[model samples]
Target: MKIIISEIPKEGLDVKLKEKVESENISSTVIAQLRIEKLEIEVIVSGDLAAEVKLECSRCLKDFNSKLMIPVNVVYHPVEELKGEDNYEVRHEELDMDFYSGEELNLSNLLKEQLMLNMPMKPLCADLCKGICPVCGKDLNIDKCTCTITKTDPRFEGLKKLLK
Candidate 1:
């Protein structure tokens, strides 16, 4: 759905979208409920989105599926304002702002951007994941490995040799 800036009605536009995005890390249907309102040269988009994402657990290194619910609140400014400028420094209030080119705004692209931005840095399958074994290379969560685990401080090696 492409929304024209100049055609926005005074009562605002309510959009319900179910868009499929296929990318490197994500392949699922994004469901978003957005409200778009244009105020002079600025456009405000506020909504909530939900999607199912495939993620790799950082600790156990296993593939898992998780549901993500993200809240979107973005203010868009026309990119025409920065056409002749080489570089523009954003202020503190401009951190959450986005730029729109021309009169059309591709809603599918915006929903995809919101999905990527809300992904967790470290994904976990479970809260108590035991991870993998350091010695024999086995998943500790599946079964207990027979390898003996020990903790040795490298700095105490010389001190232990002097005592011996």
Candidate 2:
């Protein structure tokens, strides 16, 4: 979804979209709403996006699907204005601001970015997942391994005698 700056009306534009995002981690159905406010010298894009994301459980390495909601709010300023401004350093308040060179704003890139941000750093299928057994490499969540495992390191064997 590309929008031309000149085509944006003075009252701003409200856009509703439901499209398939071609990504490995994101689902095909992506629902989003974009409120584009064309300011005097900048454009403000703010809305909400939601989708189902395919994720892998970090603990058990199992695949799972999770719902993700991402709030989109960003300001796009002209790149020319950024260059004309003093020493190139973004202030704390302008951290979310982005610079665009052309007259068209790419909505696909914005949706991709929001999806990326919504992904969990460490996805988990369950909070108390036992994970895989270290001894037999069996998945503990399915069945328990019969192996009696000792967690002590052999390198500390000499230290055990000292305690006696």
Candidate 3:
């Protein structure tokens, strides 16, 4: 979704929308809940986007469906005003009127940012996922494997002798 800065009035504007998902593009349907309130030429976007995506579990390496909720709140600044400032600082009160370049606002970048922030660092299907067996590379959650699970250290030979 693109919004032209010139279209928004000084009093600001509000937008509520829902985006549909295509099976070819994304695995799950996504809902984009947006509230765009304009302050002069700048626009303040505040909302939460929720979606369910199919992801592989990091530990078990199994496919799973996970829900994501991304909250967004950012100010758009005018391109001309944001140029050549060594230390650009905006006040808390000015958050509603952040500047951006050009009269058009690209919602793709903002959506991408929210998705990235909401992504899990380490995704797991379950807390106690048994994971896969190291030797035969078998998924332990499905069935038991005869692979011997051991921990050995080359520097521990002397320690082993002492214990024996």
Candidate 4:
């Protein structure tokens, strides 16, 4: 969605965007609400974004679906006005402030950025997920493995003599 800064009225603008994003790593239909308020020469956009995404479990490597909701708040100022000594700093009231160079504001880029930021570093299907057995390549979650799970580091072997 695109928003023209000059077109905004005194009452502000309400925008709703819903569409499927094309990416192999992420599949989502983003439902976003954007409220644009013109404060002086700046455009303040604030809303909430929700989506259902497919994520791979880090432990079991299984695919699963999860829902996410992220709050969107940004202030766009002209790039020219934000350069040099007169550069704007993010004040206490405007923590999500940003600068825009173009005549139009592109919301798609912001939504994509937010989605990337909201992704989990380590996705897990379950907290207690028993991952695949490394020795025989068996799924430990489904069945018990006969393989002896041991960590025999060469450095730790010297410590065994002290116990003896």
Clashing pairs in 2: none
- Give the alpha carbon lDDT tens digit for every residue of 81-139 in model 1: 77887887554273368889999888888888989898889999999998888888898
Q: Which ten residues in a row have the lowest lDDT in candidate 2?
A: 87-96
Model 2 lDDT per residue over 1-164, tens place: 88898789999999998867767656646789989989887888888988877788887899987888888888888888876668766543643687777898888877887787678998889889888877788889999676633556766757875888
Estimate the lDDT of model 3. Answer: 0.71
TM-score ranking from best candidate downward: 1, 4, 2, 3
Clashes in each model (backbone N, CA, C under 3 Å)? 0, 0, 10, 0
Cα lDDT computed for each candidate against the true fold: 0.85, 0.80, 0.71, 0.81
lDDT of 2 at 15: 91
Error of 1 at 48 (Å): 0.7
lDDT of 4 by residue, 1-164 (tens): 77777888999999999967656577798999989888887888899999999988888888989888989888887788866856466663744767777678888877887788788889888889888778887878888676732556667757976888
- The alpha-carbon deviation from the true structure for residue 3 of candidate 2, after best TM-score superposition, in angstroms, is 1.0
TM-score of each: 0.83, 0.79, 0.73, 0.79
Please give the range of 10 consecutive residues that has the lowest summed lDDT in model 4: 148-157
Off by over 4 Å in 3: 9-12, 20-28, 92-99, 148-164
Higher-TM-score candidate among 1 and 3?
Answer: 1
* Distance from true location, Cα of 133 in model 3, Å: 1.5
Q: List the residue pairs that clash in candidate 3.
A: 76-98, 76-99, 77-98, 77-99, 77-100, 78-99, 78-100, 78-101, 79-100, 79-101
Instruction: Give candidate 2 misplaced runs (Cα > 4 Å).
Output: 23-28, 88-95, 147-164
